[model samples]
Target: MHVGVLGAGIVGLATAWQLSRRGFQVSVVDRAEPGSGASGGNGAQLSYSYVQPLADPSIWKQLPKLLLSPSSPLKLRPQLDPLQWRWGLAFLAACNARTSRQTTAQLLTLAAESRAAFEAMLAALEPDCDFSATGKLVLYGSASSLEAAGRQLELQRAMGSEQRLVTPEECIAIEPALAAYRRQIAGAIHTPSECAADCLKLCVALEGALRARGVRFLLDCEVQGFDRHHGRDGRVRAVLTSAGDLEADAFVMALGTASHRLGRRLGAYLPVYPLKGYSITVDVDPASEGAPHVSVTDSARKVVFARIGSRLRVAGMAELVGHDASIPATRIETLAAATRAVFPQASRMAALHPWTGMRPATPTGVPIIGRLPRAPRNMLFNTGHGALGFTLAFGSAERVAAQLAS
Candidate 1:
């Protein structure tokens, strides 16, 4: 079967990879090059074990700060658009313990599968993307929060996640870069099997591999609409694009935030919104001081730092203010400040490359990974991965390919 996968981000590329390997002809369509969206500048942490959803019970307490404080890690500006209000209401509805834990459980399963699939792909291709399995530390600032994390740790343990609560001293021993900021640390939860890699380089590698396997890429191609088949009920024969009507036996809507509008055209409702995020990549000098080899996430600030080769990727902040692509100066400064406070000497501000991308988020934080009810038989979904797009791409790709095959 011939399959046309929309969006050239990691998810679409991975889906194309899976389908091609399964003996299907594949084509990737995107307005830009692969990994040019959220995949290019994400958190870079392959958080396999710490797959917690954002709409946890804790968000209830921070609702005020989320609205009032501009400096808060999560920013929510009520938009005039109805979809924003709808998405916000659903997100608020999901802010409960039971629902949060349920979402976490599902995310953990998908993340585990993604890790396995990602590893298998890495072993086969051996792409030079600064891949590392040095593990990760999620630092809590208070003893109370540390205790709270312990309860969630137990739940994850039951789900087969190898996580452990570590003391501030032990955290220092595990990652010496934390020594400078030792006084602020209350405790940390460490996951030894977590990994990190350069997502953009990985996407480039996937594109190269897919090309070698006879897969086509329609870069700079805007998908306007679709040409429907009248014989089949709501079946799409081809996607009408700026390039032309590219016919295919099957179609996969892997366009992240853009999937919602496209789905509406095809009579599907995807509760996907753009949760904007920011990141700053800084050049590091290893000889000067303690450069963190292990990935670190500041739980209080919701900022993450990962060492991808000589550059440190510092990313954080979740803004729900519609599709405003402007990168504010303060947001960039916040990430730069986080880098200073976390690992002072890890990077110099001279070469800080600031970037912003809208994460295609769902209210529940769990990705929409299969064909929806209203979607055509040939239509499938692998979008709405939100911030975990890089982490869950391979596993979702595997599932979507399997769904098509069945």
Candidate 2:
């Protein structure tokens, strides 16, 4: 079978790799290079315990504050776009306790399944992506915050995540670099089985592996539309790309944020919106204090820290209602400030590379992974993962492949 996978982000790459491994002739098309989108510049967290949905009943109280505070983790740029208003309403609707609990359950299931698939892929490919299963520690700034997270931790634990609450002293013991904040650290949730990796490196390695496996890549090719031919059975024939028309027995839409546009063209109105995020990577001098080994997420600040080799990556913040990819100075400064507050010993923070990318977010946290109900039978979707793209890539890919095979 010939399969055309759209988008070259981690999700797209993983789907293509899995499909190719299943003996399908796969051709991946992307306007940009591999991992150039959200997959490249994320927090790089493979945290299976982070299954909580973004919408919480408590968030309603914080929304006014978030809207007022420019440095707040959640920011909504004032815009006249009707889609933005619709999305905001949908987000508010998902903030109910019942919806949040249901979403959390779905996310936890996908996270665990994805973690297993990722381990299997790593064992098979042996990609040098700085993969580490050293676990992740989520820290709260105040005892009240920790108390709140404790309930979430219990929910995660009940859902089969190896997560446990730890004291400030135990947190510092597990991650010695957090010693400076020991006094301020209220408590922590340590997920022992969670992992982290260099997402960019992994995508590059996977692309190379796919090439070696005879998977064709149509780089710099923009997909204009699909070449629809109504057969006697009323099935669409092939995808028409910018290069030319290519026949594929099956097609997968792993286009990340761009999936919405393609879905609309294919008569499927996906509720995926582009949520922008920022990150800064600083090189850690070996002569100075080494970078963090285990990834850390600051629940108070909503920032995540991952040490990729000798570089420390800090990523967080969500800006809705803007397609502008330009890096905002305020966002970068906020991330840098959070990093200094957490890991004060890390040196060379002045010189850092800042980047911004859009997360393909749905109103509900659960991504769309099933076959398009209205589209041709061969067309499948594996998009709208939002901030969890790196965390859920492999499992989503496996599911997409399974759907295609069925």
Candidate 3:
């Protein structure tokens, strides 16, 4: 069987790889180069044990700051588009203890599977992408929130996650670079099994490896629509692209934010929406300075810090501003400033590689994986991963390929 995977980000590349491994002739299609989307400059933390949904009951109380504060990490620019309003309402509806915990449970299972799958691939491919199993520390600013996180951690622990709440001094012991910022931390949840890697480099490596394994890549080929057959169980025979109609036996859509528009064309209502995010990569001296070897997440600031090779990948902020991909100077500045405040000696603040991308997010934070009843039988989707694209890609890819195989 021949399979066509849409989008060349981490998700698409992983899907192509899994299909190829399953003895299917695979081809990947993307408008631009691989990892040019959110995969390029994401926070490099592979949050396996710390899979928290964005839509929590706490968002209800933080609504005022999120709406009024200029320095708030979460921004919502209400557009005239009805999709925005609809998504917002759905997001608000999902902000409950029951929904958040349900989503978290599913994500934890997928994350564990992803960690194993990625490690197996790592041993097989032996690809160098600055991968590290350094633990993750999510620092909370207030004791009440820390207590709340502890309660959540208990639930996660019930779901086979190994994590513990730690004091500021203990966090410093884990990552000495966090000593400077220790005063701001009230407490933290430490996950020792967490890992980090350069996502962009990993994507490039996967693309090359898949190509070597006879998986074709249709780069620079813009997918216009799908060429489908008739009936409820109709199969999408091929993808109508700028290059030509690339025929395949099965099709999987992993087109991130663009997934929604293209899905609508196939009569599939994908709940994927773009949450614009900013990231700044800065050159760092790990040995000479206090650059962290471990990944850190500031719960209060909503920013993350990870050392990817000699560069510090600092990313955060979630903005609901449509499909605008332009990197605003102020947004980059805010990210840089946050990095400076958190890890002053980590990197040179002036020399920052600023990037902005549309992170495809579902309201509930649980990715839409596998085939939908309303969609074609041979058609599958791996969209709405939100910020956890790199974290969940392999597991989701495995699931998608299983559907095709069965």
Candidate 4:
């Protein structure tokens, strides 16, 4: 059985690997190189414990302030598009406590599953992804936010997460680099079991493994449309690409934000929207200066910092401004300033490599992973992972493979 997987990002590559493992010939199609999308240079934190939805009740209260403020973590540029409005309204509707809690529970389960799957892959492949069990420190800037986060630790514990609330002093004790901002830090939640790894490295390793396993990679191939077969179970007979039409026994749509456009053409209501985000990698002198060895999350700034070898990866912010991949100068400046305020001597910040990408997000913030309706009986989808694309990829691939097998 030959399966054609669309989108050569991390999710698509992982799905192809899973399908190949299941005795299926896999071919991945993409317009560019693998990991060139959101999978490239992400925050690098395997956040199995911090699987909370973005549209919580607190966001409703903070929406106006976040939009109006110049230095807010989240930004939304409203447009005249009905698609954006519809997705915005759906997100607002999901801001209730009940819905937020339900989404968190579901995400926690998936996060745990993803962590296990990632560990298994690391053990089997021994890939050089800068895999490090450095733990994670989520620093809060306010007492209220710290209190709320501390309270949430109980819920995480109940859901099989290992974390503990720590004081600002203890936070610095865990990662002495944070001593630079001791006065600014209020409290923190330290998850000892969490890990950080280079996402792009992992993607490259997966792509190489797939090639070694005889999976075909069709790069620079733009998928235009699909040819359907008329039967009791209507399926995609072939996928029309710029190169040519390629037929497969099964198809998977792992296209990130582009999945929304494709799903709409197929008559499916996919509420995935692009959330633009930025990141800057800075070289750090780990020996002379105090660079944080553990991954750190700034609760106030919504930014995360991780030490991927000698380079420090800083990423954050969510801008709802459509599919534009242009990097905003102000946003990048803000991220650099915020990260420096926390760790002054961690990075030189002079030669920073900035990058921006569109993250495919759903209203509830959980990815849409399943087979499509009966019309595309042989088709499956695994996208809309937002900021957790790398964190959720392998587990999602396993789910898709199981669905196709069934």
Candidate 5:
């Protein structure tokens, strides 16, 4: 079978790899290089314990404060667009206790499967991407926040996560560099089974591995639109691109934020919106203290710190209702400030490289990974992952492959 996988992000590449391994002749298409989107610049943490949805029942009360505070983790720039308002309403509707629990349960299942799939991929490829199982630390600066996190940790533990609470001293023992902040540190939760990896290096290695496996890559080719050729049996035949037409027995739409636009063209209405996120990578100076080996997420600041070799990356903050990808100075400053607060030993702030990427967010914080409702029988979708693309890519690809084979 000839399969055309649209988009070259982590999800799309993983799908292509799985399909090719299944003996399908796969052709992957993307306008940019592989993993150049949110997959490249994200915090690189494979947090299996982070299954909670972004909109909790209590989040509605905190929304006004989060919007008013400049330094707060969540911020929404008011827009007059009706789409934004509709999405907001939908988001609020999903923030109830029942929906939150259901969403978290579904995420836990996907994340666990994803972790296993990632381990299998690593064992097969042996890619040198600095992959580590050092676990993730969630830190809190205030006692109240720590108390709330403790409750959340209990919920995660109930969901089969191997997470535990740690004292300030234990936190420092795990990562001694955090000793300086002992006075300010209240507590933390350590998920020892979680992992981290150099995402960019992994993407590059996967691209090379796919090529070695004879998977065709059509990079720098923009997909203008899809050409629906209905056969006598009323089945779609081919996809028309700017380069040329390609005949495919099957097709998968894994185009992250662009899925909405492409789905619209294909007569499918996907509720995927662009949630912009920013990150900064600081170059570690040889003379200064080295970066933290473990990944860390600050609950209060809503930022994550991931050590990728000699570079320390800090990423967070969700800006909804914007198509712009420009790096805002204020956002960068907030990330830098959070990084400094967490790791005071890091220096050379001016040497930081800042970037922003759009997350294809669904109002319910769950990815849409199923066959299109009214599209051709063989066409599928694996998009709207938002913030969990890298975390859930492998598992999603496996599911899509299974669906196609079945």
Candidate 6:
């Protein structure tokens, strides 16, 4: 079978890799180079145990505060578009405890599956992506939030997670870099099995491996439309692209936010929207006492710090203002302030490199990974991963490949 995969991000590359493994002739098409999108320069934390969905019961109360606060990690720019209103309403509907808990459970299973798949790739591919099982520590500031998180640990434990709650002193003992903010932390959660890596490096390595295995890459190729003929087993005759019309036995839409635009041409409704996020990578001095070996999450500020090799990655903040991937000055400053406050001597602020990407998000925070009902049978979707795209890429590819094989 011949498969033409759309988008060259981590998800698309992983899917193409899996399809090639299944003995399919694959061609990947994308407008930019691999990993240039959200897959590049993410938070770098492979949060296997922390699989909580963004739409939780607490968000209902904190939404207004998050929007109004200048330094808040979340920003909401109200849009006049009907699609924006629809997504917002659906997001609001998913803010209840029932929906949040259900989504978390589903995400946990997928996250574990992804971790195992990633481990297998690490052993076989051995990509130089700074892969490590450095573990993770999440710091909570308020006593109330800490207590709530502690209560939630029981449920996570029941789901087979090995995360445990730790006191502020224990947190400092585990990660000495937190000594500066030890006085302000109320509590912490530690997951010893979590890992971290550079997502872009992994994508580049995978792309090279796939090329060596006879996969074709159509870089700078923009997909315009598809030539389809409706039937019992609907198939895409050819994919119209900026380069030329490419024909394949199967087509996969992994185009992140752009997937919605292409899906609309086929009369498919994809609830994927762009969630803009920012990150700054700074060189960590070897002699610095504030450099952390383990991945750290400041729960209060919603910022995460992960040390990938000699660099510290500081990332957070989500804006629901459509597909603008430009970095905001205030948000970048907020990240720098939070990093300096927590890990005082970790990085030189003047030398940090900043970046922004649009994470394809869904209302429930779970990715869509299946063939759309109204779309062609040969067409499959693997987008809307939101913030966890890097974390879930491998497992989602495995699922999509299984469906295609069946």
Note the residue pairs that clash in candidate 4: none
Best candidate per lDDT, number? 1
Candidate 2 vs candidate 6: the lDDT winner is 6
What C-alpha root-mean-square deviation, in Å, does candidate 3 show against the real structure?
1.1
Off by over 4 Å in 2: 231-234
Candidate 5 C-alpha lDDT tens digits along 1-406: 8889998998998898788778888999888899898888888888887766886887888888766876667777778866667777888899888888788888889998888888889988999787888888888889888887777777778989888989989988887767766787789898877788878788889899999999988888887777666774334466677778767888898988888888877678778888889999887666866467778887878888887777888999888846888887999998888778778886577676889999888888889997876666677899988888889999899999889888
* Residue pairs of candidate 3 with colliding backbone atoms: none
Q: Please give, for residues 85-128, the per-residue lDDT of candidate 2 as tens digits.
A: 78778988998888987888898888878888888899899999
lDDT of 4 by residue, 1-406 (tens): 8899999898998898788888888999998999999889688888888776788888878988766877777888788878788999999999988898788888899888888888888888999888889899998989899887866777777888889989989998899999889998888999988888888998899999989999999999998989888876668899889999989998999999999888876668788999888999998965546789989999888999998988899999988888788887898898889877988888767777999988899998989998766338787899999998988888899999888888
> What digit string (tens of lDDT, one per residue) describes model 3 on residues 182-246?
88999999999999999899999998899899988899999998888876666788899999999
User: What is candidate 6's CA lDDT for residue 116?
Assistant: 81
Q: In model 6, which range of ten residues has the least summed lDDT?
A: 65-74
Worst 10 residues of 3 by lDDT: 285-294
Backbone clash numbers for all candidates listed? 0, 0, 0, 0, 0, 0
Total clashes for model 5: 0
lDDT of each: 0.92, 0.85, 0.90, 0.87, 0.83, 0.89
* TM-score pick, better of 2 and 6: 6
Error of 2 at 208 (Å): 0.3
Estimate, for each residue in 1-406, the C-alpha lDDT of model 1 and write its tens digit.
9999998999999999889989999999999999999899898999999988888888989999999997998999996899999999999999999998899899999998898888889988898898999999999999999999999999999999998999999999999989999999999999989999999999999999999999999999999999888864789999988999889999999999999999999899999999999999988875766679999999998899998988889999999999998999999998988889889878667877889999999999999988899888888999989889999999999999999998
TM-score of each: 0.99, 0.96, 0.98, 0.98, 0.95, 0.98
lDDT of 6 by residue, 151-221 (tens): 67777888889999999999988899889998889999899888899999999999999999999999999
Clash number for candidate 3: 0
Ranking by lDDT: 1, 3, 6, 4, 2, 5
